[model samples]
Target: MTVTRFAPSPNGPLHLGHAFSAIVAHDRAARDGGEFLLRIEDIDGVRSRDELADEFRADLAWLDLEYRDVTPQSQRIERYRSAADDLLAMGLLYPCTCTRAEVASAAVAVGPDGPLYPGTCLRRGPTPGLDVAWRLDMEQAVDLAGPLEWTDERRGAQRATPAMFGDVVLWRKDAPASYHLAATLDDAADGVTCVTRGIDLFRATHVHRLLQHLLGLPVPVWHHHAVLVEADGRKLAKRRDAPALADRRRAGEDGRSVAAELRAALFDTGISLSDIINQQT
Candidate 1:
């Protein structure tokens, strides 16, 4: 059985980007005759909200995006912490004391992996006495796994080289855990056999897959589709001008309409919203 998930953060309202991702997940799960799950990534307590999470759920429901279960990231901190501790105990992780500015100054931005480290801190890796963000010791971990290939629904198969995504952080210095750690742990715990999201995350998927390998978790199949874009040719995000799902609902646009718009805009499906809902089973 292919268990897929729609793991969206509850820090903001659902927008068009979210809609595209959500529909892809829901559709692929149905097409494959598998289970669809909703995982609420709300570990960032400073920005995450109960109301926003509810709104996300309502939006997915309105879109008729069905899932078998719902899991929240905040509810699984212990698991992520356990994973971090296990890495720490294995000498596979080190405390990174570098600040954002320090990292930006030290590392060069190569691609989606963010920075190609100059090994400034890796040379002084694994500070035993201090509490700092835990980073993976890539040198030791590389021999275990090499180039990994992921199959995409739209763009086809892609490979991630170690040169691109190396020694990514398992936890942030100020934060208890990072999104990468939390997400991979939850996927394993929830038995997600497949992952479907936007293509913008293909590179990030490499980081996630590397984490899964390091953490010794089952790697899931990936299907990344094109992200929905704004009129300005930018991706839609909650923090910006995109109206909240609540606002759209208040204005009387059904979930089906939004879902249809997403399909038409991104996937080029020219179908009436009402007809799309009627055709979906």
Candidate 2:
């Protein structure tokens, strides 16, 4: 049986990008007679809004995207902590104290997600009793996991090169777990057979594959669909003032018709998954 999930962070209102990804995951599961699940990735502490989560449910219902189980990351803190503790014991994790500004000032190169951390904090050693985020030592982790690979349903098999991401945070300073740690752990726990999301996250899979290997979790194939872009060729983001799905709903637009249009847009552009991964807005 195939199991897939549409996990969304409730930090803001759902937008077109969120709608496209959620619809794809829902349709994919239905086409394969698999179970579709919904996850609330609300681990960002105070930044996550409960009201936005309710709005998300309403948006799903408006689109008629039915999901079986709903899992909230906020309720799974202990699981992430345990996983981090094990990695710490294995010496694969280290404490990082660099602020965003500090990391950007010190970074030498830019990766898919902002500037690559320069590993400055890793050299300084741990500051006991001080609040610090736990980072996975990517070089050590890749070496320990050995050669790793994962399959993508749309893109075929590929080797995992976790070093491309540098040392990613497992436990965040403001949150119990980072997105990579929580999403990877929850996917395995929920028995997800296939992972589906926007192709913008294609690079992050390298870090996720390594984490799965280190934690001895059941690996699943991935399906990274193309992301929704704006007329200005920029990726739609809540922080960037993208219009909310609620705005459309409030205007009394036909939910089913909008969903159908989105489904058509998925392949109408003749854009490959690789193109989506490589094209930077």
Candidate 3:
């Protein structure tokens, strides 16, 4: 059976972009008679709000999106640690003590995510007492995994090239696991056959595919839908304080109608949600 998931971090409130993504994942599973799961990516202890998880559920309920199961990363910290230990044992992960400022100063080239880590820690070797983040040894890992590829529902086949992100972090100094490690593991653990998320993460898939190969995890087909953007083309982001779905719900707005409008805007109208609202007004 096909299984799809909508994994949302509870660091902020859900917005229209999140609504569209959730609907896409839920509808895809419903169409295929598959299970749709909701995973709360709340591992970031610093930023994650415990109350936001409940609000996420309420928001989804308002949208009428049903999920088969819900998994929270906080409950699976041991699993993440075990996976990281396995990678460390295999010599695929190494401890890095470089600060963001240090990396920025040394980095000469930029990668998909940003200024790549300049291998400062890898060259200096592990510092014994200093707290550290664990990074993947990309060159060595790519050699071990050999050639790899994953498919997207819309984009078709893609060759995996995880090196573009340069030795991405698997474990953080402050968090149990970095996104690449935890998300890949959770998808496999939940038996998700189709990963549905926004296109902005399309590049991150390369890193994920490599992790799947390294950890002997089940590979899932991906569908990276177009991100909902503002009139200026900037993606709707919580950091930018995008309008929250809860605000609409509290204001007596019809959630189903909002969802229907989003669906039409995404699949049929080829227009922005603001444009649809403008026309209706």
C-alpha positional error of residue 189 in candidate 1 after TM-score superposition, expressed in Å: 1.4
Candidate 3 residue pairs in backbone clash: none
Please give the CA lDDT of all the candidate structures.
0.72, 0.85, 0.88
Write model 2 residue lDDT over 117-230, tens digit each, in one string: 999978999684458888888888988999999998888998998898888888888888888999999999999999998888988888899999999999999999988776
TM-score: the better of candidates 1 and 3: 3
Error of 2 at 122 (Å): 2.3
Models sorted by TM-score, best on top: 3, 2, 1
Which runs of model 1 end up more than 4 angstroms from their true locations? 125-131, 266-281
**Candidate 3 to native Cα RMSD, angstroms:** 1.7
Ranking by lDDT: 3, 2, 1
Q: Could you give candidate 1's per-residue lDDT for residues 1-281 as a string of tens digits?
A: 88888888777777666777778777778887988898888777588787777787778788878776566777777888889888878777777777767877877665465665556676865555446677777766665567666666566777755446667788875556876678778889999887777666667876677777777898888877776555556666776656566676777777786677666655532223333234433
Decide which is better by lDDT, 1 or 3: 3
Clashes per candidate, residues 3 or more apart or on different chains: 0, 0, 0
Candidate 2 off by > 4 Å: 268-281
- Candidate with top TM-score is 3
lDDT of 2: 0.85
User: Which runs in model 3 stand beyond 4 Å of their true positions?
Assistant: 128-130, 267-273
Give all TM-scores, in the order shown.
0.86, 0.92, 0.96
